[model samples]
Target: MIIKSPFTELANARQTPPSLVSEYDSCVDLIGCTSGQDGAHQAPGSQLAAKPHCMLALPGARNALTNAALAAYERYQMGQPDPRQLIDVLRFNVFYAFAHNAKVLGFNDDWLKYEAISPFGAPQPSPPSQPIAASCPANMKPTVLQMTVEHHPWIDFLPCPRMRDNFLRQVRDKGEDAVDEDGLCVDIVDAASARDPESVCLVTWGKPWVLSEWEVTEPFMKKWAWLLEGCTELMESTNTWRRKRGLHDIHFVH
Candidate 1:
């Protein structure tokens, strides 16, 4: 049985001919015509489009979310494993879009992890149970705390012994030049660095997914200064660039 979207009136009320309008309209039309008509009215027309291949828009808080879900599903069917399931993909896409947009808007750091408060540059308070005194030297008087200085923490920590051994093996295979920053791998390093800033795609979980940024070289973080935009802005920016190049946005396949 066909189910009508609860947002049908709201969608129509907006009257915005955004990029996803056609997709929504197409799906809505599909829902209305052959919702409960069984397989009898299954044809390609305004009144009978929802047939054996009935494509209902995925349930979501917004059409953009649904569109992203559809895109993720399409990508998964094409062999991308990051979006291995529907619900996970939907949640990830929403969060990704939110975080990406936030970075674009100048909130470049994670809100929960990174804090910006008064007394700038001062270290944040650690939990009482995890006192710094516990790790201090015996000669240092923990009771009468004086000025103390410590080396910066190492950011990269190899947690697994096997992984570390495997890394060393790989390094040995590559020779002394493996650890050199400006050695024979300079070209590779330069290529990777250059592509990060020059590429017009969003990277999620190591896989590249083309999101708006078309014609733009910088990542979304460096391009925009606010997270107040959504799919419409993305589509507009990318579509405008595509039109300039005599191309159009690619369609999603079921």
Candidate 2:
């Protein structure tokens, strides 16, 4: 699952929120969230509410990331002991930012976490030969590639071997000036053009696949397939280019 033109991280001020939704109802059981819920009941509702570690993630009108971060912080303030892992939490948040809307994000201290690196798995493909803008410093581990699959008109123009009622499509209307995880904008177009797809190939079982094999199990995979299928249409679709590149989909520990 590689997004040639995924949304960029906001390295500066002002940002666009990623499309994330919360996993739970917007509230925490104050009486018992930490050492387990049973303790709060034992202490009486009023006494349990005084305990920390029970807060809700509410962003108000702010971007999803900020709102979630603040909510996570508030939960800690309520009695959530310091995990001394803000860095890990932040890094972990990045893992879920794209698809889910969460009020709290975890943090991490790893240099890789903040290096603007894409997720771990991308399939091997023809790398772009064109020179592009500067995204990372001279010596960076993973540079986002400019190659991408967008929702094209070809889907309507070309006859499809498979007609999908439900599908997933990742669109990158604006590239160069894109937003990052923190909701800041940066110039990533140049670095994107110089991408080498081989560097981010997807992993399957123990081997790397040049392309993501269709997943038979998950709904996310089904939508992802619609995205790829729309792009790989035999005819009718027009090809476009992305000015900036960032990591999307393709993540997890193998």
Candidate 3:
């Protein structure tokens, strides 16, 4: 689903507050560190050394490495493939690296396993076909929208009708110029506050996952901030085209 924002005007204004800009820069730096910048990966006899210019070439590399190491340790404890064996460690590291990288890049888990990681290891289990249910009971009627691309059909189930109504009201108040027939435009602040004071839920393909405010903002604070603006422009442009055809506006849950 297309994620649309009402703050496109402000973002387009290019008037970000100085303090927020500085904070975003700091977060980018932190992500760089985790990507092996600032000698963050230096260890006694460590063979991995990140190139200065390639700090973000492998985002989430450090965490992936750590997880690989832990998985090796677990295997050792279970008297399975021992980490003492170089081949075993290599296999574990390669698999975990692909797995974690896929997660960081927001790829489907099955896609990573079957298409990416499977070639390096034993066959993976088939992806599950069961639909996931929301943790909390859905308080609002599910709203289904047609997808532009071929994919599984899904519906948005908000926690309450007030949240849904508020979005509709915002669209009405904003009028046609702000309304996008491609998707519903929502205020980021309103969306975040609707979920909780400190958290929000992002649903993909009917699966709901809750993320804290920090989790939500961290991506935008890092090297991917420009993507948000790109999405904003895409929605606006597409909606403008769709509106000319007198199509009704669509909705998406972020």
Candidate 4:
């Protein structure tokens, strides 16, 4: 028995090209045509396509594209900068054009077979949590903080432990006067591992400062503000994984 496509009315209403609609129907039939004993729609094979592959197919593709378009529209409504909104809108247009091109080129069933055996096609396991100790002493001097970082056991938890050595070397080469006057210090690891800007006690011989204590005149801010912003973004993304494990929220002083 032949089944009527659910997309028929949608295709007619949207005036979608016949070729594209036919391609969509084929994809739906390939993946969602069969139902298992559990009443869940299963692909012909045991393997399900990775999330991205599924998202690019049939009804999933339509929903994903629509969401992308709506996000761009919402950005415009919110009065975001024109350039930023332009990027968002252009992203939608580019993906829409790519989808059209893919439809015209025809579908490849072999791609599914390849994806089924690929490691990337499976969901990745979460990285094991490596929490840093909360041992930052209050009112610690910058030099003492540096020393503590050099000898501290938690220093090993940094993504790049070599950064600690580099930081120490730079501070030593710059001399104490430069550190005091220019704030020539770096946050080696605590801001990332501890995931709290306030817990950042591992800094060079300069002003003992937290993220909240920003000074425009400070040389460190003038030179490394962008680096700090980048690190904050990384930490924020890491917080999602941390939250799943019921870990404390990563705090940024500012």
Measured by TM-score, the strongest candidate is 3
- Tell me the TM-score of model 2: 0.18
Model 2, backbone clash pairs (residues 3+ apart or across chains), number? 39
TM-scores for candidates 1 onward, in order: 0.18, 0.18, 0.22, 0.18
Q: After aligning candidate 2 to the native by TM-score, how far in Å is the CA of 219 from where it should be?
A: 1.4
Candidate 1, position 215, lDDT: 23
- Candidate 4 regions with alpha-carbon error over 4 angstroms: 1-65, 74-82, 108-254
lDDT of 3 by residue, 21-53 (tens): 111111110000011112132222234343222
Clashes per model (N, Cα, C within 3 A) = 2, 39, 0, 0
Residue-level lDDT tens digits of model 1 in 196-252: 112212212211112332222123223221211223444455455445334445321
By lDDT, the best candidate is 4
Tell how far residue 132 is off in model 4, in angstroms: 58
Q: Write one digit per residue (lDDT tens) for candidate 4, span 1-254.
A: 11112121122121221211112221111000111122121222233323212222244544554564465444434544232222222223323322322222232222122122111111342211222123432221123333432222221222222323434343355442222211121122111122122212221111111221111112222233322333453344334433432344443322
lDDT of 2 at 125: 31
Estimate candidate 4's alpha-carbon lDDT, on a 0 to 1 scale: 0.26
* Candidate 2 error regions (>4 Å): 1-111, 114-171, 174-203, 212-216, 222-226, 231-254
Give the residue spans of candidate 1 off by over 4 A. 1-75, 79-84, 114-254
The TM-score between candidate 3 and the true structure equals 0.22
